[model samples]
Target: MYVGIDHSTTGIKVAAIGDDGELTTAFRIDRRNVETAGAFLEVLDDRIGLSRVSLATVTYAFGNAIDEIEGIEDVPNRGTTDLVGLDYGTGAGATVFDRLYDSAVPTVVLPGVHRGLDTLHAFFRHYSALAGADKVASMRYALERFRAEFDASGAFIWVCASSSCMAGLVCGGRLTGFFHWVGPVHGWPDPEAVRRGVESDFEDVFMRCGLLPRRGADLTDVHDIADRDLLQSVYWSTLMNVYALYPFARDLGADGLDAVVLSGRLMRRERPFPLGRRVYEACVDLAPVRFAEPYTSAQGAALVARDVAAGADEVLGIPVGDVPGGRDR
Candidate 1:
């Protein structure tokens, strides 16, 4: 079996995939509940049968320190350049990374999309970072989803709308650009938010500047917000973010998007309003839009582990590294 670990904003998610590429087990652990790596491993063993894992692919925060998929031991600073504003709860991600490094399971870490990556278009180098490693994993799944469902492989955009909104473009089968959450328009921050971040603290600004938070909505219970007006605002904001990516996609030489894959916690919610369907309808005119499962990132990571163990050299344009004992699989 192959395993994938996603250290997300609210929790640590693990997904195990059998040799046939079928999902066998999946679970999420609250960051607050797992203070130590031992605690995390114990929970993982209980839920996914750790002893049976052949290879485990893990994603931590930022992932800007490296540009290739590398073994856990080969990465520096746990695959990050800095930890600013990443101390979610109990620093569980750090604990999980450290423990996985010393564990018996062969593990590899993924890099985030950033200026340092040579695969991206030169225009995207204006920003320092685009998305995290989990986003790359998500893009991997989106690529497969696009090919499997839409039967096209030209180009596509993956839009993730959750606590924050961001989009990535895959053109010519390579990750070429991204619409990051830090941008001024339709992203997490507006001019007002930038001013507020300057006044108070910019560390946590990204988490506090989304459309929901800007409208004074509670993020902890985002799915529970009953205000139709607020939901409409969020729906339109997400649509606008998607709309903003079309020109960029075309500029990168994509005739047009083969499809647009939508994923994230918000895209899966149905309460108060059918936000996911609304967003999909808004974009159906542009291209085929598909909803991805919530476990997409982890599942994609599992696929990565499987392919790397099978001696594949690259995944979705991201180069693979020599994973010490991985080829033995």
Candidate 2:
């Protein structure tokens, strides 16, 4: 069995793949309540026998084997980029990694993209996972959807939803070297900020963003304002952040590509909430836009696992198990 874990900003997700490569069991847990390594094993034990499992892969908590994005470097590391190996007791990945190590199970860690310039050239690269955590971004998901419908290939732009939202390019199964930047503290807008443009007051629109504080109130039958103006503000914010990384995309225009896709928790909403819709609509004209729901980084991790287990020469320039680095290049 192959185990894939996504240490996302929201929670820890564990998925087990069957021998035939089908998804077996998947579970999610809050990032905070993890008390010790035993808690992780307990969860795995319930899903499948630990001894039967062979390979386990985790995302976002490990060190960067290839940290730079293909072309951009100004954006600093956020989220797990600063913490490699999950050894820090405070970092969420640390507890998870520690537990996995204690089990004496074979494991592999994923890396994030970083920005750095070539010593000999004026060019820069946004180094990250070969496919950026092996997850589909908005554009990649859209391309899959678009190809299914149109029977054609096209370029795409994607933004992943994790602790920090990262945008990249995807075309012909290859991701972009360029991407935009925004960490939680820097990119996520305050609810009050979303309300500024709407006729509704800040509190009125802030609640509409689907994030609300729990106050132990027996409140039921709430309302979703669906305010047009509030939605537009959120839309603009998403686009601008992505556009901020446009230079990297231009640098990697090796193939003709144009279009956008929306992926992430924001894409999962059934109704095109104001923020989500605006972002989608704004980019629709750029190319035919599409939506891919239930974004799962684990899918990417599983793909990488399959590749590594087969003895890939390189996974984004880092050695995979015993494979020598740069052999794939």
Candidate 3:
């Protein structure tokens, strides 16, 4: 069995996969459960049975520093030297990475596709510096494994719609470029708040930026776009993410795009908000759009680990490092 770990803004997500990325078991350990490696282990408990994980794929932080997928121990600064660059719950992610690094199981770390490494294109300049690695893992996992799961193939534009909306492309099986847009949901500093010295740190402000927290208890449970103004904003933000990335996708080769994949908490499995559906409807002009399972980064990362363990040099066309004998170099 192989495991994939996604240390994201909220918590540490883990996925155990059988052959060909078939998800066997999955759970999310709260951020509070991962303050330290020992604490993390206690949180994991028997839920994961880490000892059984023959190969583990872990993703952390901007993923900017590391170009290729690498071994956990081999990653630089947990895969990025620029620590203070972006704060998307990175401290928690790093702690989780350290936990995997010290473990007996072989851990493969995936890189965050960015201007720093993937391609120095004008479109992928500064904004992608600290785009979460989980999104990259999701993109690769979606494309590389989409064929098996859906019997679909070819290039596609993937939008990770969450507190933040990030859209990118996989052209010819390669992640070419992307656009990052953070909605008011991820929080932006209110000039008045900053003026009153409310909070200086953007991350702190950004954490409170989501629409759910901004709303009261009554509307908290409301998921419909019609009643909730928050969902309207969210719907607009998500749509813009697709609109922004459509150009990049088209530039890469619109003709090759097989589909547009949306993955995130907003794309609820049970019922998609009408506004969100409308937003995607607009995006259909570019290509047929669909929502993949949420938190696919973990599954994708597991797939990478599985493929690498089988002596594959790449996962979903993303070249991974050669960890000889599954030992850290």
Best by lDDT: 1
Candidate 3 structure quality by residue, lDDT tens digits, 1-329:
88888976557888888866678887787775676444665555477776777888888776777777787777767887564425544467767777767767678888776765544346677654736678777886677545643332356778765656677767666667776645434543466435533535444544444465455333234333333555567677777766666566557544546777877776662343455466577778776777787658888877777777877766545676776334333
Task: Give per-residue CA lDDT, model 2, range 1-329, as digits (tens).
Answer: 76777765556777676556566676777766664433777777766777866666665432334342211112223223443212333656557766765666556655444332121012324333222343422232344345554322334566543333456555444543434333221232354546452554432221233222122221121223233443343345457755654444445443333655566664444454644566666677555556554534664455455556666644433334342111243
Candidate 3 segments whose C-alpha is farther than 4 A from its true place: 36-38, 42-45, 85-91, 119-122, 126-130, 148-153, 184-227, 254-256, 269-275, 324-329
Residue 256, candidate 2: how far off, in angstroms? Answer: 3.4
Displacement of residue 96 (Cα, Å) in model 2 is 0.3
lDDT of each: 0.77, 0.47, 0.66
Q: TM-score per candidate, in order?
A: 0.88, 0.63, 0.80
Candidate 1 residues lying further than 4 Å off, grouped into runs, are: 36-38, 149-153, 182-202, 215-219
RMSD of 1: 3.1
Which of the predicted structures, 1 or 2, would earn the higher TM-score when compared with the native? 1
Clashes of each: 0, 22, 3
Q: Give the distance in Å from residue 222's predicted Cα in candidate 1 to where it truly belongs.
A: 3.7
Better of 1 and 3 by lDDT: 1
Best by TM-score: 1
Residue 86 lDDT (model 2): 23
When 2 and 3 are scored with lDDT, the better candidate is: 3
The candidates, ranked best first by lDDT, are 1, 3, 2
